[model samples]
Target: MSNYTVKIKNSAKSDLRKIKHSYLKKSFLEIVETLKNDPYKITQSFEKLEPKYLERYSRRINHQHRVVYTVDDRNKEVLILSAWSHYD
Candidate 1:
């Protein structure tokens, strides 16, 4: 059972649609599933993004791209704010 419900914003949905690499898209989906279970669980690239990103957290999809999201513990939700190349 998932402890957190993952919600992707329309902008993030647009970002996913722009991904040309099939494998990278697959990796993004897998990471979303992981977030549903434990949004705070640290992976190789998972890290909190404060000061700059407020309460958001980021997880790398690759050297170029990442998923940026914020977790709402009170409602058990994870809102995906962005899913695209970080340097863009």
Candidate 2:
């Protein structure tokens, strides 16, 4: 399989660095893999974008986590914005 190039903001990178649980770390990696496999799932969250946030992409893992990202269509990169444990 080809490698998918993903970009993330500095703040977001710092945020990801703070994750403590090993399980969540594994799940987070899985989420990135899933994004490369199915990008349309990113576009599938149009209805949920908040007023202050740009509605680019999202994914739900199990029932407790959300992975939100900003899509760079020109470069075909998924820039992860922030991850929330619940509706934050």
Pick by TM-score: which candidate is best?
1
Question: Which is the leading candidate under lDDT?
Answer: 1
User: Residue by residue across 1-88, what tens digits does model 1's lDDT show?
Assistant: 8999999888777887876455787888889899999998878999888776488899998888899999899999999999898677
> How far is 41's C-alpha from truth in model 1 (Å)?
0.4
lDDT by residue for model 2 (1-88), tens: 6234676677666547644343577667777787665555534332245654665666764356667777656677777777656454
Tell me the number of clashing residue pairs for each predicted model: 0, 0
**Alpha carbon deviation, residue 21, candidate 1 (Å):** 5.8
lDDT, candidate 2, at 33: 80
**lDDT score for residue 34 of model 2:** 72
**TM-scores, all models, native as reference:** 0.88, 0.66
In candidate 1, the residue pairs with backbone N, CA or C atoms under 3 Å apart (3 or more residues apart, or in different chains) clash, namely none
